[model samples]
Target chain A: MSETIMLLCAIAGTYLWRALGVAFSARIEPDGALFRWVSCVSYAMLAALISRMTVLPLGSLAETPMSFRLGAMAVAIAVFLLARRGMFSGVIAGVGTFIALVAFA
Target chain B: MGQPNHPPGGRMTARAVVRLGLRRGVGLPSVIVMTSMMGFGSLAADGGISFLTALSASALVWGLPGQVAMAELWAAGANLLTVVLAASLANARFMPMAMSLFPLMRGGTRHRGAPYLLVQLLSVNTWAACQEIFPAIPLHLRVVYYTAFASTILVAGQIGTGLGFFAVAFLPKPVTLGLIFLNPCYFALLFAGTRVRPYVAALLLGAFFGPIIYALAPEWSLLLTGFVAGSAAFFFFDVRPTSVSNAESK
Candidate 1:
């Protein structure tokens, strides 16, 4: 079926990068220039994705107001810094703030 | 308990290693995966995907961005090629992630096939957790620990997918929205906690460029933002020091 074929292609496309990483990792040095650049690129890419999800989200998240989303992120960052980079506290604060704002609004 | 050659408390049995991994997996990291996958399940349901198909995509793709892209594209009635391409692009972070992680996992093991299997289970949650935890783990047990940890989150994600699919009709909108928003918040906090200068610069530049470029070119925004911001950060923070040292030596 076409659906199954589509699914397979999706799987193959997604795995292509991981598989390539495995093949090239055997030859690549972790501390090399290439690795450093790649690491930067990966972090940048994750940042871009997170920003998009927060600023221009789809699905249920898109229903919330932009102020709430931005406020939640700001609060999370502040809490993370104040808590000495405790990941749990930051996440709990952000989610809690967003939920409270949305529920009240 | 009394092997003559074994160092005291320096090594553990495979069963004990796996138990430790399971315990670690059940913490905040797995909870993040579960809630995010719950969001994905709700999205898939809204997109008219069957429960089985959505769950299979979660398992097979095993990456939230790719799964979400695939679901959204399929829902929009896009062609097969477009769907595959979008999903692949969204999941491209796995390449660098695996490149970095595979080396850490390569020690004290001779098994050729284990990396292949472990790579399949790799996700953002598992990859991040492994980076934090692998240093404390013994080399021989690294593979087992990673396997147990990743598999636990994978199963948790599946359970979340099922719950979200069924609970969407009953749960309040704000609650579902909060569940969906957890991932971005968690990721932002994770990156904010990094102490590396180049990485921090990349994060800031990427965040600044993301929305602007997205408005201009939605499909290519991620790639473009990475290339521009990452290169700038690399040149300034990483390459400048080396070049200056070389000049001084000359």
Candidate 2:
């Protein structure tokens, strides 16, 4: 029960800024320097999450070896390039390669 | 479709706002968000988070990455502090999102309460859609329109997460596997959609630096890759001359 309450508090804390930002937009311009810094931090944070997923995944993905993961990424990149930067093909290629390798070997 | 018939003042009614939101939100952007959210919720439930927390996070955070990060950390038995830190880091990107819109929305409303409400709609899906659609709408309606559309999705996400949590057993293991993969797959695809030199540069640098940094220091890989790669890409693109930039700028 305490865990649930804590989780709720944390979730609310996380969203407080967004809710607060809009409420105060009359005073804040997205173009202000402070906003720019916020933008930078946001982009940086997004990059961090993406990197962590690719490099330090959890649960089932954690079981997949490093070599296989890297190799699958390479194949995905090659497919992406070959498809002239198509997003769907790149994903299919990467995921397909990973599954195939894992299933076969 | 041509612009919907407007009222005598050339404005949309409250009902119209809700209708437009439901319609526009059912399109590609909302689908992507819903797809990602469903996958995320399922993964959280399968991993042992209660349906309540998963649902509440979607309702509150409304940011998919942060919600996923929080769930993963909690499942891993990390303390509340670590979970918040990781979540805040994932959410730190919102600061930029909020900043970009603040300029556009600054003087439109005299009421002090509106900005706080508007901020809830500032996630990747809403921001990207608003950036595309706001210029087309009458300036005054942008906030109302976005609030309507975003609230629909937010409410949907909350409900979806709750349903996913309790219903995890009904969803097959293969489906859950697919859900776990969806989060990464979406980002990978979205990253590929960028054709800008700097964005492409950031993706490549991130891809290259990510694993390498992890091998060296797993605990700090996310911060290192983002700062190092993103800064390199930012400077490389930002410092170039305007004429050269115009050639590749999109």
Candidate 3:
């Protein structure tokens, strides 16, 4: 079936790089050119995806008002800054704010 | 009773090291991933995906955005090829994540398939946590800790997926909204709190350009935005004279 095939492809595509990284693990220096490119691309790609998701998400998230999303993100940002990049603390704050906004507002 | 030839100060046994890794990972990092992954499961369920599909995707893919993309695209009735392409593109960052972390790990290549198995456990959360923990541990225990910690998180993720699929199935619009924001919020926080120069630059430029380009060309926006913003950041850092930074040794 198409569904099975799609899932297989998805799994393979995602795992390929991870497998390749293992294969070439000790050979690559973190600051080398290829590593730099991978690093830059990774950071850039993640940033773009995160920003886009926050700014313009899909599915049920698209249903929520952008104001609520922005407010939640602001709270998260404040928490992240205050906690000095403690990731869970920031996410916790954002989730709490987002729930409160959605429930009460 | 067993010694594994630890580095100069490796005072703990491998079992102790593994326990420490699992204990630390089970706390904050595991909780963060569970919430996000549980949300993904709920999202997938809400999108009409079957339980099996959702579970396999999370266990196999292990990336929130890619899982979301796959679920959403599948819901939209996208072709098989489109689904694979989009999902893989979303997963591209894991390559760098794996690459950067492997060199920092210790003795993972000692056994057959150990390195590959270790990489399988290395999510963004685990990778970040390892970077924080690896520098402090002796070389001998580093591999043990890394494996235990990452696998704990991954196991937690699988359980969360099941919880989201069955227990918290079809989350109400409000909680769904909140759960969806957690992953990106985590990353945005990382961006805001980053100390590295090029990464900070890339985050800024990527944030600036992501939405504009998404509107302009949604299909290729991720690749285009990353390539442009990342390249610009790389050049900005590379071309600058390192009198203050590079000239001095670490």
Evaluating just chain A, the predictions reach TM-scores of: 0.85, 0.68, 0.76
Q: Write the per-residue lDDT of candidate 2 for residues B27-46, one digit (tens) a residue.
A: 64555566567767877876
Candidate order, lDDT descending: 1, 3, 2
Which has the higher lDDT value, candidate number 1 or candidate number 2? 1
Query: Which of the two, 1 or 2, has more DockQ?
Result: 1
lDDT of 1 by residue, B11-72 (tens): 66778778877888888877888888898888788778889888988888898888888888
TM-score between candidate 1 and the true structure: 0.87
Model 2 bad stretches (over 4 Å):
A16-44, A65-105, B3-21, B196-199, B206-228, B239-250
Show where candidate 3 strays beyond 4 Å.
A23-26, A31-37, A83-89, B1-13, B111-113, B168-170, B238-250
Candidate 1 error regions (>4 Å): B1-16, B239-250
iRMSD, per candidate, in listed order? 3.5, 5.6, 3.5
In the range B1-250, model 3's lDDT, one tens digit per residue, is: 2333344446767777787788888998788788888888887887778889888888888888889988888988888899898888777677667766776664645776777776767677776667666666776677888888878888888888888877554466677767778888876775576677887787788887988898898767887888899899888774444455334221
For each candidate in turn, give its C-alpha RMSD to the true structure in angstroms. Answer: 4.4, 5.7, 4.2
Single out the weakest 10-residue window by summed lDDT for candidate 3 chain B: B241-250
Error of 3 at A105 (Å): 3.4
| Docking outcome class, model 2 | acceptable
Evaluated against the true structure, the overall lDDT of model 3 is 0.77
Better of 2 and 3 by TM-score: 3
